[model samples]
Target: MNHRPAEARQSPARTTEVGVRYAIVPVPVLSLETVARRTGLHPDLIRRFVALGLVDAGRDTSGRPVFAPTAPAALARVQRLRTGLCLNYASIGLVLDLLDRISLLEAALRRAGMRSDLPPWT
Candidate 1:
């Protein structure tokens, strides 16, 4: 008797091509306090990141900043990059931007049936 919860039993990215129904749980919208608690970063730091354009935030009806569910992971990545590489916030922001661009380009290339390989850094 498999007694897994409905959510636990279903894969988030299941596709009909594999005879499974596709299901994507909606991304959460979080408040600043919730974001701080979830990410273990101070609200001030999160604000700073926003000011630095490191993380993007949307506004609530009250004109307060709100974050997406993915913000915590993005914050963690910023912290890791800062501590691991000793990079300043500006540099970190640039790196993240480049990484996002690379991802978009790779996806575009894949759709166009072109190989998108990284150039060797020598």
Candidate 2:
């Protein structure tokens, strides 16, 4: 019953002009309402977060904001920092920036074959 070509039975990888094999994966883009529902936060609160630059979003063709799939997790992190640490939005932004910087530095250290836990002087 199989009349398809042999290539159709294999993985969905495609060969480019450069002979590079790659799979096309579709990334999900969430709307503002969807992000709010997933994060259990109000749409207005999500808008506030967006205004404060706490979450990253892109405007769709309709001029509505769209978020990455990670937006919910990012919102959760923001909530945790807000309640658990009792930090304001501004402070949370600074903390997030520092955390991101630290992560990048750690990744660079890892790529350089150095232990991130080691003191800088060491």
Candidate 3:
């Protein structure tokens, strides 16, 4: 019982004047206080994450740090590593070092014309 129409079997896309745009990325913009509220961390510690260049936060017109939606997940990971593993800030440095290696691997792959659908942390 194959009753699907030909158009229905076609690739799903919004028919706009600019053709097809397949990527649907979620960009959540959050303030520092909002990130602290979401991650249950102190504002100062969130600032430290920004200072360490761990989270991808950017500025609004007012020039305040606005975190992405992924920031909460990243902060949760860092918090878990710090609390559960009893990792000091210095050990956090080591964790970031390993992550940087992974980043280098991904960059090399990209430079070699390979692709990765996963994030660096994943």
> Which lDDT tens digits does candidate 3 get at residues 10-102?
344455678754423444477899999988889998888677655556787889988666678877877877888898866765686677678
Candidate topping lDDT: 2
Prediction 2 TM-score vs. true: 0.76
Top model by TM-score, which number?
A: 2
lDDT of 1 by residue, 38-122 (tens): 9899999999988787877867679999877777888898899899999998889878877877887899988987777755352
How would you encode candidate 2's per-residue C-alpha lDDT over 37-99 as one tens digit per residue? 888999999999888888877777899988777788888999999999999999998898888
What is each predicted model's overall lDDT from 0 to 1?
0.77, 0.80, 0.69
- Ordering by lDDT: 2, 1, 3
Mark the 10 consecutive residues where model 3 has the least summed lDDT. 1-10
Better structure of 1 and 3 per lDDT:
1
TM-score of 1: 0.70
Over 4 Å off, model 1: 1-28, 118-122
Q: Rank the candidates by TM-score, best first.
A: 2, 1, 3
TM-score of each: 0.70, 0.76, 0.56
